[model samples]
Target chain A: MSRLIIPLSAFFFFMAESTYADLFSGEHFNSSRIFVPHFLFIFILFLTIFGSTKYGIIYGFIFGFLFDVVYTEILGVYAFLFAFLALVVSRLMKLVHSNIFIAALISTAAIAALEILVYEANGLIKDTGMNFTEFATIRLLPTLLLNFAFIIILAFPIKRIIEKANFESD
Target chain B: MPQFFLNKRLIVLLVSIIILVALIGFSVREREKLSWPEQFLKDTTGFVQNIFHQPVQFVAGFVENVNDLQHTYQENKRLKTRLDEYVKLKTEVQELEKENVELRDILDKKESLRDFDPIQATIIARNPDMWHEKTIINRGKIHGVQKDMAVITSKGLIGKIKITTQFTSTVQLLSSMDPKNRISVGIYGKGTIYGFIEGFDQKERLLLMKKIPYDVKIKKGSEVVTSGLGGVFPRGLPVGKVEKVESDQYGLTQVAYVKPSAELYDLNHVIVVKRKISTTESSSGAGAEGDDL
Candidate 1:
């Protein structure tokens, strides 16, 4: 059941991120801050902490590639970043306790890196007119806040699920 | 250094970095059509996205309906007053259309720029990475939708078809920062004056229309529409109203800031305007990117 549950739920979280973004965007509620969903990314952070780093990295690469094809139309931007971030986070997991609070703090820092890297990569390729300050205030801040809120809500449940799965990397 | 060369993780990272650069470069190039693998992936995922979007749209529509319920009485009262005028104008339009067909018959003319078939499509998904203003809709090549066709909401023009798979197509909105994004526009006042929609002013939230001869007197609030001279869009599709005008930096031409009539946000449904008469590729200026109509 744990095996069935892990990958399946990660996929749900991935789909939910996009669907939730769709719900909040446009005429429904008008906010200057653009809230991007990093739900799947946060979930992968949890996977690295309590489940298996190996599984986390695999899932990250797959979903990130799907995200590119489905949404951005760019091929490798998300794939390379997601896998790279997963690797970095797994390395950090070696020194850290798996407590919810510590996990939350580390995830916040990871999310920040993710957002900045994406903004830089896209800006370089696309020539987006948004300046650094505008991106920080309008896009980056809200995305972090939104993903953190997602983390706060599901942090405990996800941790429990991953541990119960008892994933073996060695 | 020899030890580093033996590290598996380091080699993997270097390989991925090279691949990333190649992938981004390949995807960014201007291609006539997407490759087969891209088409297959898009169609399959578009199916899933369409499924995800439907429930959300239903709930949104329900809430909108509930909100509309509150305004029903006032709306009906206003619409009642307009009903008489609408009936009168409807007959006039019908009579003019009949006369137009008769005149065309006499001249043996077979086609007009205004002739188009509107295909209804639903929004399936939007660009998750909001760097580009783009949306996916549920009509594509199989549905007769093609690249560069004008897309409109009920309110007015919103965008043009960018890419079409077998089952879904991508629309690039007017607000995109793409330098190649341009549309031929006709500003209607006393006479129709032509220009191209150059770029969007993000701060002012208005479209920049440029290249009009400096001497043409354009009034504030004059309507701008697709001229069909663009070779893709049909004639007379409402685009926006000009809010302000200024001279370009070189002082050879005038620029107008247009506020689009259609709300490009929260798009649920759109019409793909497929022009009936095939137009030969013409160098009508900056608008026609596609070779065939």
Candidate 2:
């Protein structure tokens, strides 16, 4: 039962993200600009800061690969992005104190950085045909706000679960 | 072993970077055709998404139905009025269609308009990453769904299939602002004026129809439909209505902003149109000249 906790949690997180994505797939609030909630990344970030970075990176790789396979045209884009972001967040955690507010702030910054990386990577391969300003205003800002709200709502419960899992593993 | 030469973190970083670059390169090349492992993963995950999506969609649809109940009376009245007009128009359309078919038979035309079979599919999932603007439908190669086949809702044209796995396929929406997915369209009015829908304007929520001949008299609200000049999409499928038309910056050609007839935001069931192979071959020969523009 204890061993099943981590994998089950990760599976649930994956299901949650995909379900939410299906529910709010298209335009939101009748606005043309889309807001994609990075729920899975937020959970992975919580694990990295609170449970163990190594485990977080592993989960990131597995789930990111799944996301690539399920949702994206090209494979490895999300897998690579999520794992790389986990690494960055884990390293940053060592330098900064692990407080809820600070962690939320760090996660927001990390997600913003990740979004920019994805935008650049897509532009390199596919020529997204969107300029920097349009991307920043239309895509980046809304995504940040939506994810930040998600982090605030789920941060406490997620941190509690990771802490419990860490204690049990010990 | 020399400690300096065998630094663990440095070695890890180097290996991961190399792996990342290789992964990106591999995926870019494999975007169109998936290997066996990729296909296996896509099929399994697509199955799971379908499992999760169906239940949620049922609940969402139930709630929407409840909300719609209040307006049912008004909607019923409106539809009833339209039904009368529709019955009259239906006979007229059938008569005209029969006549058109007879004329084509006499002329020995090999291909007529609407020369394709539509495979119906429900949208299972949509990419959360908005930049991709892709939706996954529960139809694939097994169901005769292939890449570049046009997808449409009952109202109008929506998109084309971008990639297909065993059980699912990705649809690249018309709103995707990608230049490579341009659809050739023509305005249906007093005269036939053709152009290409190059990209979408998110701000105005309109499709940009570019490179129209400057002298063509395109009026606002004229119906725009596929010209059949594009080998992939059949001709006469309604695309949108022209909202505005203006000359290009260079003044060489005209550009029209079109409001897509399909409600792109609310997609559920869609039809994937598979063009007949012989027609595609024939059309490609004739459309080769127009395709250059």
Candidate 3:
């Protein structure tokens, strides 16, 4: 189970990086609709609940490091944020029944909101005066809607793969 | 009570093993060296990365193949007419070929040139966003391709090597769409006219010689060759030709329209000019004259 989870989580991270490149980095969209997909988020959440928190944090750090390298953003910022988010998401996993689609949608929306807040804060520090309201309505909102739509379509198949892999390991 | 199931001795043994490994790792890092174990791990990781990346490569290759098929269809239509022209010229070509052999012997007596170990590389991947940007060549450091090496096609100068590793290298094409690319150009049968070429817009086009002095007599059609002023590119290589010339406001300089000889969109075979490792004068000065393998 440990061996399978290690490689499987790495695969998920690589896949997410390759697909979400130039899409989720908040570079494409405005402040209103900056969003991220929740596949890795959900994976960390599921693993923390059913497997281990240490594994969750480890995988989160690795995933976020790769994200920082590819996205041309500050190092360790996303790593720390992802680790913190994974902990909170794991806690929420205890209350919700295992519905991957709903989990992915909720997580993506929350992460997107957090990302916008960070982006706005950075803008304020830099004195760029880039309007957050403009970005939120134009970029973040659209991305959130699009990501959720995609999650709804992909959740079933990805969830099945995760479950099958875990089951086979056992 | 939580840990009572495991033996204390076994726990101590595991902890001690981890401590020892940590000490070794710390020492290795402090020395800024890789231990045997670390080297093995690095090699293994690289091997795994190469294996996992096979699928990504396959997708890139498939895209290249589809793009090539489209280009082949276009070329086929043109080549059908060209084939008839070649047949008619065959008789003339034979007589010239014999004369060319005698001329070559005379030229050999006149001057000698150095030999190059040229290797042909196929471009594997290219960035779509930076359409006129750098491309990744399949040849890498292991393949005797070094940094600063010149890359050219049968037609003319393409670019040079910027970065290289064991399996791949990124080549900065001449038409990188960057303003920094100032090429020294000379119209055949005329004095060298130096001007910078750049990308005009999103149309995947070249903006050549935007502001040349209007006094310079440039015809509608003239071959532009590299001036070899830059240490990077060799002398007298075909870059492109003048298509149209327009005057800028005030008419201080003529904005000449130019098109590249090589169709970069459909580049297949490119030769990486391996600078002669030794100076034996074998096929030397090939860069200055007609293409010699």
Candidate 4:
């Protein structure tokens, strides 16, 4: 159950972000401002902070690969970035004071990095037509706002779950 | 900083970066279709997405109904006036269509570009990433939803099937910023002015139809429809109307901004148009030009 907990919840968040994408798709919803949900990545952040590092990184790789295969045309883009972000965040947490607010900041920054890296990776392959100003105004800001709200709601619960799971693994 | 590189973390990161570059390179290359393993993964994930999509779609449908209610009285009045006019136009269209069929019969023509078999599909998942405009439909190759087939909503043409797995296919919407997504379209009301819908204007949310001869005069609100010159999409599929027109760079030709007839934002059910002629015989590779793998 302990081992299954993380992967299981990761699957839930994976399903969640994709599913909830439909909710914002209404007639009145702002077509220009896009909200991309990274609930699974947020869960991974809590795990990196509260659970064992090895488990956190592994879950990141597994779920990241899943996201790439399912949602995106290209493979390994998210797989590499998700695990890389996990490792980076875990290392950074060691230096900074790790708290709910600080984790929110780190997670937001990590998401920004992830979005830009993916955009740059896309530009490397083909014509991504969108300029930087458009990307930041239309895509980046709304994504951060949505993920930050999710963090505020789910932070304590996710931290408690990861800590409990890690305790059981011991 | 040096201590950060002292451990196996650096090696893992470097090796993974190398692998990522290789994988990206491999995945980005042009290919006919997804592999069997990719097909399987997509199908399984599609199944999960379908389960989650329905309840949310139901709630959204409810919300849309509520929003629609506000304009119902005015819309009803307008539609009621149009209904009487529609009866006369319907008969005229029927007569013209009958005459067209008779002329084609005399010419010994069996199929027209307008003939297509529509495969109904429900959109199960939309790409959460804003970079690309793509939606996953619950129909695939098995259901006659082939790559490069025209996709439409009731309102008008929306997109083409970009990729097909075993049980799911991705519909690349007309709003996609890909330069290769050009479609041969003709504007009516002045004896059919021809041009190609080259790209979309991200800022204004209008499709850019270009390559019109410079001297040709185009009025705003002219009906633009597919010309059937593109082998994949049939003739006379309503694409949009000319919202505005301007000269291209160097003034060699004209560019018209067309507001797409279909509501691209909230897609639920769509039709996959498989043209009979394209299916019975090999296509001419004209429409296949937009296909990127």
User: For every model shown, what is its TM-score relative to the native structure?
Assistant: 0.90, 0.90, 0.51, 0.93
* Clash list (residue pairs), candidate 1: none
For candidate 2, write residues B1-293 as lDDT tens digits: 24434589678767876887787787766356677887887788778778877878898899889989999999999999899899999999999999998998999987755688989999877777766778888898898888788899999999988889889888889888576778888887777898999888877789999999988888899999997767678888889999999999999999999999997765789999877634455445564343321
Report the alpha-carbon TM-score of model 1 versus the true structure.
Answer: 0.90
Q: Residue B248 in candidate 1 has what lDDT?
A: 97
| Candidate 4, residue A111: lDDT | 91
Residue-level lDDT of model 2, residues A4-24, one tens digit each, is 676777766776765676567
Worst 10 residues of 4 chain A by lDDT: A22-31
Candidate 3, position A32, lDDT: 22
lDDT of 4 by residue, B186-283 (tens): 98774779999877877678899999999999989999999876667888889998999999998999999999999887788999988776542264
lDDT of 3 by residue, A34-153 (tens): 344445555555454445556666777666544432231233444555666666666666567746655775567555854575565345333322356755664456656765676677
Q: How well is candidate 3 docked (DockQ)?
A: 0.10
- Could you say which candidate leads in DockQ? 4
Tens digits of per-residue lDDT, candidate 1, B1-293, equal 24434579788889989999999999888766888988998898888878877787899889989999999999999999999999999999999999999999999998999999999999887776677778889999999998889999988899888889999999988888877788888976767899988778765668999889999998899999988876778888999999999999999999999999998777888999998777645545544454322
Each prediction's fraction of true contacts recovered: 0.50, 0.52, 0.00, 0.58
Off by over 4 Å in 3: A5-155, A160-170, B1-77, B87-116, B122-135, B152-158, B173-192, B198-200, B203-225, B235-270, B275-293
The TM-score of candidate 1's chain A against the true chain A comes to 0.92
Interface RMSD of each: 2.0, 2.2, 12.5, 1.9
Ranking by TM-score: 4, 1, 2, 3
Q: Chain B, model 2, TM-score against the native?
A: 0.88
Over A8-57, each residue of candidate 4 has an lDDT whose tens digit, in order, gives 78887887776666456423365666678889988987888778667778
Candidate 2: which stretches are off by over 4 Å? A167-170, B1-7, B29-32, B108-110, B277-293
